[model samples]
Target: MKSRTYTLVIIALAAALTAGCASVAERDSRDPLESMNRAVFSFNEGVDKAVVKPLAKGYKTALPRLVQNGIRNVFSNLDDATEFANNLLQFKIQAASSDLMRVAVNSSFGFMGLFDIATEMRLQKHNEDFGQTLGRWGFANGPYLVLPIFGPSSFRDGLGLAVDSHFTDPVYQIKDVASRNDALGLQLIGQRADKMDALAALEEAALDKYEFTRDFYLDRRAGLVYDGRPPASE
Candidate 1:
């Protein structure tokens, strides 16, 4: 069943890419599915307003700073493995080594990542994902996409998310299914809570929220791919 879902997601991403290419010369050239994307974005916004925002607010209010930091640290530590793998794939030996060491330090001295001792030890963290891996391999960032619940993405990053979820996410590797799901949920909620302030500011400042979101996400992804200095063409 999981394999089937992965295959379907890949097929859909391919179709979206082809459609994006076919319409690149006209309209919202970089986002050929603007109409559909706007609709999805609206739905996502509604869901966020109805459920996510309230939950994030409550989570922020209920959790103490120390606990929240610990939660964030744990999730970040788990993500280090994914970063290590992507760094290796991108031929970033130094970054891969740093990520591996961070993971080891956090898992041992930090008590399964309840704290981030690696950062204090002067070990820098690197942001590496499958999307950046693809970019390093010369894959084009396809059209912008608005995923259900997930909000803004691009064809390339969307596929990268799928790959990470299905393969690299350590939360899913837990033997106890219920515990894994709980951990994943907590990670999502913690992230949402962490971003609440920034998101509120963005909502207040943006004239066209959709366009602002799309542009910001694209810019951020570009920086991530090129390690904070994207090329002029990108």
Candidate 2:
């Protein structure tokens, strides 16, 4: 159920990215790839105006309690493993080691579901997401790609999606066809839901929404590669 919802959410989001940039493409006559990029941004803008913003608002209006947040934490724990792996691959030894400890302790305590018990065990969750992993591996931000329906992403980050799907995902382990897909999709949507509200707030007051989004995406990608610790000055 949750997974299926999440799948649609992914589709919807991909469309959003593409569509959001489409309008910009129309105004600026660029090369073939740039035109495509614009179209994606156009589509994402529309989805934001329509679906993404509303879903985010609805979620925020009804806050979860400690118990529910705990459960959400548990489910999110499964993802920490992959994040750990990616961090190691990207050369963030300290954070990667921390995630490994998290997975070990959580799995031992049956908190593999990430039930916040891991925190009590002193296993902190180091924030990790896929796009950042790609940047560290020498992939240039190919182009600012507004993925139609997917919302904001660059060509580089877009490829990151495939990396995450292939390596980080544990969905393949789910036995039941319906349940597995449902769970996977739900997770994706849930994460998206968490971000939508913040994004909406930021976008609402931006001067040049497109440029703002473009710069924002790049800045975030760079920040992630360096694990929020800015590089040392020369």
Candidate 3:
């Protein structure tokens, strides 16, 4: 069943990429599915407003700042394992080593990652994932896509997301279904709460929120792929 699901995802992503290329001449070159994307974006906005934003707000109100930070740190520490794997895949030995060290220090001295002792000890934190690994592997960022609930993505990154979620995400690897879901929910709420201020600023400032977000996401991904020094053409 899992193999079948993975096959279906690969097929769907390939079809989307092909369709995007075929329609590029009729729409924005980067966002060939602009109409469909806009609809999904609207749906995501509604869900965020009705469900996610309220939960995030309530979460922030209920938790002390220290507790919130601790939760964030714990998740961040777990994410270091993913980073380590991706960095190794990308052949970034230094980064992979640092990530491994961070995990070890934070998990032991920081009380199972409730605190970030690694950072204090001068070990830099790196944000790496299968998406960036695929990018580094020379996969083109296909047409821009707006995923329901997940928001902005691209064909390549979408596939990368599937791979990472299925194979590398520590939370997703939890053996207990209910516990996994609870952890996932907490992580989502915590992330949303952290981004509330930035989201509010974007809402207030952007003339076209969708375009702004899409452009920012694509640009940021490109920068990440190129290690903050994208080629002039990008």
* Top-scoring candidate (TM-score): 3
Candidate 2 backbone clash number:
54
Candidate 2 deviant stretches above 4 angstroms = 1-35, 48-63, 108-110, 120-122, 129-131, 171-175, 229-234
Question: lDDT tens string, model 3, 98-163?
Answer: 999999999999998999999999999998888889889988887787776667888888788778
Clashes of each: 0, 54, 0
lDDT of each: 0.83, 0.62, 0.85
The collision pairs in model 3 are none
Model 3 alpha-carbon drift over 4 Å, by segment: 1-27
lDDT of 2 by residue, 1-234 (tens): 324334544564465456556645334222224555556568777876687566645655565655446546756677777778788877889888888777777776755664556677776677665667766666666555655555567655666665665567565356688887766655545666667657668767848666677667666767776767645420
TM-score of 2: 0.69
lDDT (Cα, 0-100) at 19 in candidate 2 = 55
Residue-level error in angstroms, candidate 1, position 178: 2.3
TM agreement with the true structure for every prediction: 0.90, 0.69, 0.91
- Which segments of model 1 are wrong by more than 4 Å? 1-27
Let me know the TM-score candidate 1 reaches against the reference structure: 0.90
